[model samples]
Target: MYTHTKKPTGLCIELLESQGGLISLEDFHELWSMLRKTHSLDHLYPLPTDTEEFHLLYIIISRDQEHGDLGIHANGYGIEDEGKYRLAGFACLVVPPNERREKSILSGNPNGICDTADIRIALLPAVQKRGFGRFVVHELLGHAFDTLRIRRVTASVVSPVRPSHSAAQKKQIGFNTKQICRIFETFGFKFEGISRGAVMNTEAPEDDKPVWHDVHRMSMLVTDYFEEHIISSLSTIRSPCHKLPLKTVRLSPWDTMIQRQEEEKRDLKLWAEAPKDTLANDACDEDGENSDVETMLGDDDVDEHDWDMANDFDD
Candidate 1:
């Protein structure tokens, strides 16, 4: 009963843009608050204070397709729908405004083609164990690569520990640290090493006692992605390499004759320049086998300029 839309990935995923008409900001915030209460990590990963930031967020909703006949839209097991789509999970992709700076020294400098993006994902407890989390990650990465042309995507998480919001509720209910790490790994992200004691957690019982977290970072490259998913995995009838199909080449008889004559003339000129025995080597040399380091930054005539601004501690 899942209505198939354009975005309809394998898991019946419906990605509603946070800035769009699918859902309201107040409702999204309320669902996030409920999520906070279940696992509640205010000290380690707190929700953004400004509602304006929600524009960068996406709401991952799950529908009760089987029961659509009854007009029922269950969010997940026991959670009340209350005329709202069941909030299954959410994700955010942070692209810094500067576009030149790096998220961390570990993420490295922008390689010009694929910009780096900071990734964050969260799933509701009721829908935690299902494969929906992986689908969400796939959708996000696909958007980053196809739409934004980003080359590398990264996500960092603090060392997992039980979280508590208040003295009364000490139980933690969300995905643990190890589980979270596995989700990223399943999507081809490599472990990029950790930043030791990068962030502090001050929610310990005693006000004087504070906990420090060594943030673990992960990264994925666009080339590695194409190699893994498209090249190694799938088969094609036209090209064995599995790249995009080439446009068909069609030529009329007159054009073909003219092209042959042109090719023959070029071959005669090449033979005139060099002996037939050494023509292959000369062609290789002309093809830049002896060329110096080449670059795609721009034409060589363009002059380089120095960066005038000092490095700010941002992104």
Candidate 2:
């Protein structure tokens, strides 16, 4: 079961898993389908359709009561045909493994034990300047820190360091990117690093070297966000709807893929070094010494039990 919280603006936040419940599963599909086509303010990046590989990908949809106008879609200025309950905007929370090697570039901890997550938010262009984006993000943080008890939250912002091709493109880049970084900064996230060519430009050819753009990573520790609550010795501050049972989802396939990749890399390393060691060792060397080589070459001794222990967390 998921939880529901009413925001000060009369918008209700429904915390849902991949399989949604507060809204019909069909509605959730419609939201994601729309999001896939929507671009950022600069029309630079769009949500990728293939998201099955990511674990702990949860959708946070902000909804408001139906009004005189159904309102405009976030992607375009055209009015939506949908009913009273307008889907104001949506955000995504991605939880990667604490020890993921690829993510170490962002977290700076190879064997980090703290629970951490990344956030990506998108609000309709019509609703862009109304503080809806900030609200959506706060809800996500509340869930991460209060419910999931995550220690750190990180977000990526497109940096203006990349060269723009046209005058129009330059203007779009300056406006949208700054707004993105500013929003996160307002929530106490600190500037971490600049990742060169980390973001891909959808308009450019995939093979083009410059298709990638620089991105600034920002992070907010839980201690910084909830400092006031702790200082007051309050049991729990009612920032996001209080004390809701957060849904837990276990994505086994993603975890399996990580384990498989780790094993493949380890095996390759062992085999690549085997040839060099065999040539240097004396033929008269003890059989026990040669046993180590045999163990590396023998696939039968590969431990399957160890792989089973690498389980993905339920978010």
Q: Which prediction has the highest lDDT against the true structure?
A: 2
Candidate 1 residue spans exceeding 4 A from truth: 1-18, 40-56, 64-84, 99-114, 162-175, 202-205, 235-315
Poorest lDDT segment (10 consecutive residues) of candidate 2 = 69-78
lDDT agreement with native, every candidate: 0.56, 0.57
TM-score of each: 0.52, 0.51
Model 2 C-alpha RMSD to native: 22.7
Which 10-residue window of candidate 1 scores lowest in summed lDDT?
1-10
Pairs of colliding residues, candidate 2: 66-84, 74-124
Model 2 residue runs over 4 Å out of place are 1-6, 15-17, 20-38, 41-83, 98-114, 159-164, 203-210, 228-315
Error of model 1, residue 80, in angstroms? 18
Q: What is the C-alpha RMSD of each candidate to the true structure, in Å?
A: 24.2, 22.7
What is the model-wide C-alpha lDDT for candidate 2? 0.57
lDDT of 2 by residue, 85-135 (tens): 455455767765445545754677554334777787765554556566666
